[model samples]
Target: MKKVAILQSNYIPWKGYFDMIAAVDEFILYDDMQYTRRDWRNRNQIKTPQGGQWLTVPVKAKGKFDQSIRQTEIDGDEWRDLHWKALSLNYRRARYFSEVVEFIEPLYQNSYRTISELNRAFIEALCVYLEITTKISNSWDYQLIEGKTERLSNLCQQAGATQYISGPSAKDYIDPNIFSDAGIALTWFNYEGYPEYPQLWGDFSHGVSILDLLFNCGKDSPNYMRFVKK
Candidate 1:
């Protein structure tokens, strides 16, 4: 059966996000939806010696009302250098920092006008690093319907997915009956059993960016993420 997952693009998302992508046959970047303020779409937590810190991409959200993620634009070109500097300072001592730094540094150097573009670039790059072979697509390619769950269900149907896979957080709002009505099986993904890998700083946190795991564990990073190929 072809399992499909639909999730918004996130900036250097955590291992759990990639795990979900790895578990599905097709991963859809649901960018046609409204862009929420202060969400994972433009920012994400990164582990630091002090604590988990946010590295947010400044976006121009002044006049746009309910702007779709694909239409949202970056505010300025200044965040790139700042973000790269923070990562370099904090993760410079990571075990495999040198190995992964070359590949990751260029991403920050390149210019991106939109948040979705920047996020998709990183997500695709990290998926390759983790050996995840799932086919990735954009939700804008499908004709979305109105309503929350209906839009998701329609996206799955458009992709010809026999099964719809979703994150556990969606259990609150997602109706299983919707998928049943669409003749698609529904499955919930759990990110609870992740084992801590060699992490920097004192306490380990699973909420930080996947770059933490990649820089710290290098080739063995996939071993820590569920569903990722070894």
Candidate 2:
């Protein structure tokens, strides 16, 4: 059976995010959904000497509040250098910092016009390091129908998916009956039980970006994550 998962693209998302991607056969970037401010779409947390710090990518979300994630434009190019510098300073001493930097640093240097592009670029690159070979696609690539559950179920059907894998948070609004009606089996991805690796900071946090795991564990990063095979 073909397993599918759909989620909005995130900026250097946490390890759990990649875990969900790795658990599915086809991962869809649901950027067609409306963009919300102060969300994972533009920023993610990172560990620092003091505590967890947020590295936000400034986006133009003032007046155009109804824009989709794919349509969202970045405010400026200045945040790029600031984010890269912050990561460099905080993770410079990580065990695999130098090894991961060879690929991670250049992502910050390249220019991306939209958040979707930036998020996808980083997600694809990180997947390579983790050895995840799931097929990634965009929501707009398929014909979208009406209703929340109907749209998701329809996407699965269009993609020839027999099973749908979703995050637990979606249980608040996702109607499983919709998938049942479409002859698709629904499964909830568990993000628990992640083992802690040798983190640099004083405290261990699983909510930070996947970069933390990569910087600390390098190729062995998969050992600390769920779904990804070591």
Candidate 3:
């Protein structure tokens, strides 16, 4: 059965995001929707020795009140250098830091005009680093319909999905009736049962960037995540 998951692109999302991606056959980046302020769309937390800190991508959202994620532009080029420096400082002492630094450093060097593009680039890169083979695409590529749950169901239909899996946070917004009517099975993704890994901070945090798990676990990262080897 073909399973699909649709979610907005997040800046260096947590391990749970990749867990959802790994559980599905196809993953869709739903960025055609309106962009929300202070959301995972443009920023994420990273573990530090002291605590977890947010690394945000400053976007030009001053005049454009109703900007879509695809249309949201980076405020300036300086954020890249600053973010790279922060990551280097925080994760430099991670167990597998040296192994993955080469692959991740280039992402900061390159410039992306939009937040969606930058997020997608990092997501795809991290997926490769974790060996996830799920097909990824942008939502604009599909024929969008109206309504909250309807739009998601339509996207699943467009992708020829027999089952639609989503994060538990959408339980309030998603209507099982919609997916049922579409002959699609709906399942809520669970983020429970994640074991603590060797982390730098005093408290182990699972909500930081996937990079945290990668830097700490290296080639054994997938074993820490829900992704199962075939």
Candidate 4:
């Protein structure tokens, strides 16, 4: 059976996000949805000596509340150098920092106008690093229907998915009956029970960007993650 998962693209998302992608057969970047300010679409946390620090991509969100994630343009290119600098300074001592930086640094150097493009680029690169072979697609590639559950269900049908895998947080609003009605099974992805890897700073944090795991573990990054096999 083909398993599918749909989620908005996130900027260097945490390990759980990649776990969700690895659990599915086809992962859809649902960027057609409206963009929300101060969300994962443009920012994510990174572990630091002091504490968890947020690396936010400055986006032109003022007065454009109705814009979709795919349409959300970055405010300027200035944030790129600053973000790279932060990663370099914080993770320079990480065991595999140099190795991960070889590929990741270029991503920052490249210019991406929209948040969707930026997030997708990072997500896809991380998936490759973790050896996840899930097919990634854009939400706009399929015909979207109205209603929240209806649209998700329709996307599954269009993608020939027999099962739909979703993050546990979506359980609150996702109606299982909608999938049942469409002859698709709904499965909630579990984010619990993640074993802590060699982390920097004081305490262990599971909410930081996947880059933390990559920097510390490099090729063994899959060992700390759930769905991706080592």
For each candidate, give its TM-score against the true structure.
0.97, 0.98, 0.98, 0.98
Question: For all the candidates, what are their Cα RMSDs to the real structure?
Answer: 1.2, 1.0, 0.9, 1.0
Top model by lDDT, which number?
2
Question: Which residue runs does candidate 2 get wrong by more than 4 Å?
Answer: 228-230
Candidate lDDT (C-alpha), each: 0.91, 0.94, 0.91, 0.93
Off by over 4 Å in 4: none
lDDT per residue for candidate 2 within 15-44, as digits (tens), equals: 999998998889999999999998999999
Model 2: weakest 10-residue lDDT segment is: 221-230
Per-residue lDDT tens digits for candidate 3, residues 101-133, read 988999999989999999999999988888889
Runs of candidate 1 exceeding 4 Å displacement: 228-230
Which is better, 1 or 3, measured by TM-score?
3
lDDT of 3 at 17: 95
Q: By lDDT, is 2 or 3 better? A: 2
